[model samples]
Target: MVFWILISFVALAMAALLGLILLRAHSMAEPPAAYDLRVYRQQLSDVDKDLLRGVINDSDAQRVRTEVSRRILAADAQLQKQSSGSPQPKGMSRLTVVLAAALLIGGTLALYSLLGAPGYGDMGLASRIEASDNYARTRPKQAEAESKVPPQPNPNLEPGYADLVAQLRQTAGERPDDAQGQALLAQHEANLGNFIAAYQAKQNYIRIMSGDLEPQDYGELAELMIMAAGGYVSPEAEELLDDTLRLDPRNGPARYYYGLLQGQLDRPDIAFRVWVDTLRQGPKGAPWINGIEAQIEDMAFRAGIEYSPISPPGAAGAQAPALAGPNAEDLEAAQEMTAEDRQEMIRGMVARLSDRLATEGGSAPEWAQLIGALGVLGEQDRAKAIYAEAKTRFADDTEALAQLESAASMAGLEP
Candidate 1:
């Protein structure tokens, strides 16, 4: 009787345990709770009352009642089973103990293989997440800490001429064929008054462009070359102006500059021609045109030529003070020469200038000056040819080469 009573008690405990497990599993399998079970029960009661009062149809009442009853019975069954202790471990037989030990060892090994070290994977993930959150919350402070180190300028720089020369030399070395590099080197040399070096660099840059230089580059190059000339006229520079005009005849800047170059070369006739051309092509009241007009008037006056000048009325509204006619000195300078003689002189000059530039090895800026001098001397053909050859050779150097071509063309030479 005692053994039977013990068996019965054990069976009851197993049933209760089984019921508790089923109840817990069922609860876990449901969707996560959005509201209390008590609220659900209250809703059910309200619906039941509505049906009883005929506020809802019989069919709806039936469906609602059936669902509620099913859930309640399932809950009751789960609770009863949990209380009965339905689950119990097998007896402590030798075979049972061996199997249990084997399971325990296998489970530990499986967990280690599948999940890595117990606190180094998922556990580590949680730690990382916490750290990331902390970092996000203090991100501004972290950024401020990082920004405490101020930016630093180049260490090897001494400022002024030394730095400029060093940088230019380095840039030239690194980018041998780069026009901008050449320009920079030329700039440094010019600043140092190394005109010969500057001119050489400028010409080398122009020579590299094998006919790929653009119009804008041509205009800028002409401007720079004019500045580089330092007041000497050269056949090469005349050829550059010719090429510049050919590329973009309508470019007012090019036209105006060409006029100035012509003036320097002692070709007032051509200079005045270009200045007039600018006036016709550019806006009537444009500052560039007005400036060129002023220049033309001044030149005309110096040549003993008459032109409309802005002058104040004299006493009794008499015309403005009239200047004397061209003096012997002015006429001698402006004397007309045969085209043949002019061409011969230009040819000789170009030959000499080319030799100096090539054998003597001038700088880029000096070369620019030499080119301008050629234009002023009326060696337009030689200048144009040089610029054209440069364009053909330095196809990649658009700006410098284009300037050479434009300046040459503006001087009325074919490139």
Candidate 2:
């Protein structure tokens, strides 16, 4: 929207400038002074010649010559006054010619600056223009994707989160060592309102970034782990994201995901800075920047923290501590787990959660996951009641409340 707005403004400004130039040029093209007088005198001469040849009456020729003489005298007097004028101001003396040329060139440049070049992508004018055009073309698809975003989790999941847990167990079994697959499983768990499982999977994904993985692959893994951190305020998850960024400072995905996680943590100032830095580094009109900015704005609005219009005044981004934590160590351990063991473990954990939620009802630690599963399973009323109960029951535990709220939001269940 901002990009299109800017383009419209530029187009209007260019049209206005062109109109002004045409108007000025028209004003400068006044009728010539001496030419009109000269033509009148020539006509008078022809009348006199006709009279001498007895072609016209004497009175008519005399009257025409008098008017022609009067016009000639008026033209001469005006010319003499113009020629006799005092010198122009010193600033404009020989500078008139220079100033006129300067005005023409400078006006063109000023107009171009205001309306032609958009300072985007840290690119040259031509490059910026091209990129802006390209972004414009793709923006509609991006907007539609945003608009059509699934309302939280799909509404076919069931309560006690049995279906979600089952889905994750199945997927984990299918792709035990796949970082992306595990990350997707983790995200689905998160969408199912299972923060613990999400946190576990995210930790596992982060832990596996090791000697075998390329820097780029590590960066991608870091991004998913950071993104999954939004499900829980795990100090471990935070540390992992911070560490990933430290290892790959310029990874756009890692930076964006980290920014989002920061926002989730209600660190608007930090999130804003990270997003601003991302915008500075990436190509102009980058979709990531828009997404990050939107997240930051939403976070700031929710937290009632005023986001600085200007980014944080610093060269450095979010700072991380030197030491790794237990979760990080656990991730490292998970990386060493045999694929079969990992699959069996996740399956057992999901089954345990399902059993606990079914027996213990909404008071269980895994109730939210059940609610999410229930929401997906088309138990809309049950999910809403469960979410409302969780929100009220766990009101004292901000983390629990937040998790419940997140689940409700994803489930599209009113709280």
Candidate 3:
């Protein structure tokens, strides 16, 4: 009863307001603005004063006075008509206003009755959420299908890479004692982003090379493990990364991957700092710089910092020194040229380097450079041949053997 009483009062109040508007509209039928008569008479007086002062010419004053006189006459006529009490018609007819008000109220309520939950009670926030939850529970299959789909394998892997992987697996299986073969398989798998096989091959290689391990070896294993876990650096990988940094604090790949792990763990602050420092220390021509630079921009955005990365410390003159021993200008020029021209230039340079190594006998670093250049150019077969030749040439020198072997291993050359 109280609810019905309140609704009745609201309806009555709205009707009363509408009636008042119609009444006022009726009163404004004549729109009594006869004040315009007084304004026009004042303008006529001003024009006469201007004529007496000779401020405006007599002809101009006469025209202004005539216009003001004409407005005065129109206002006087309107005022006289308003005061005549002849029952002037209103601008809006009374019946039309009544019908319009009725239709507005009725149409609004009718639309609400048609579209709204007229019979249902109000649903608060909690009730709405609970209703959604009930809907989800009612369709278990749909919810399951929509909310959880099995992850798929990487679609971007090269088809030929899988064949290489099969051959690599066969070799590793047939020669379990061939750790070097396993190491090469690991690198090739990693390059192809087949991190699961890469991790397995790296595990085998690490076990065999336990006595001859370096920080780089541990870092490689950590990276493979991280990739196998789909970018999540697991606790096992973290331990490997720690071991890598313990042996060598400035390992670029290890540190970069460590930063990635930090980002994955929701520590953008730590990731940003690590990557910024690593970028500063690394050469601009480093292969990983491009990836790091892209990642660092995202990190900076999430960390809410406007970061402008400076070129690595030693890239002052032309370009950062290439790891493959190309001069700064050559590498910079490669970036500026067309792809075909760049390839031709690179082939020429590689040929020259190869010719020099074959005839004059350059340093171990030079041989490593040629092999690395071959790797970058996707000539892994040629790189493997170069690695074999460099091994024989550096057989008497342990340091030279280590450097050349490291380069060859990076290029995916088997022992």
Best by lDDT: 3
**What is the overall TM-score of model 1 with all chains considered together?**
0.32
Ranking of predictions according to lDDT: 3, 2, 1
Assess candidate 3 and give its TM-score to the true structure: 0.47
Which of 1 and 2 is the better model by TM-score?
Answer: 1
For model 1, the run of ten residues with the poorest summed lDDT:
314-323
Residue 77 displacement (Å), model 2? 71
Candidate 3, residues 314-395, lDDT tens digits: the string is 3311232333335667656655666456556657767888987789777777888788668655588999989989889879
Total colliding residue pairs, candidate 2: 13
Off by over 4 Å in 3: 1-66, 75-181, 191-193, 307-405, 408-415
Give the best candidate by TM-score.
3
lDDT of 1 at 197: 60
Off by over 4 Å in 1: 1-162, 187-195, 261-267, 280-294, 302-305, 309-415
Residue range 247-333, candidate 2, lDDT tens digits: 778666667766765554445556677777886775433345556656766666754677664343223212222111234454566
- Whole-structure CA lDDT of model 1: 0.54
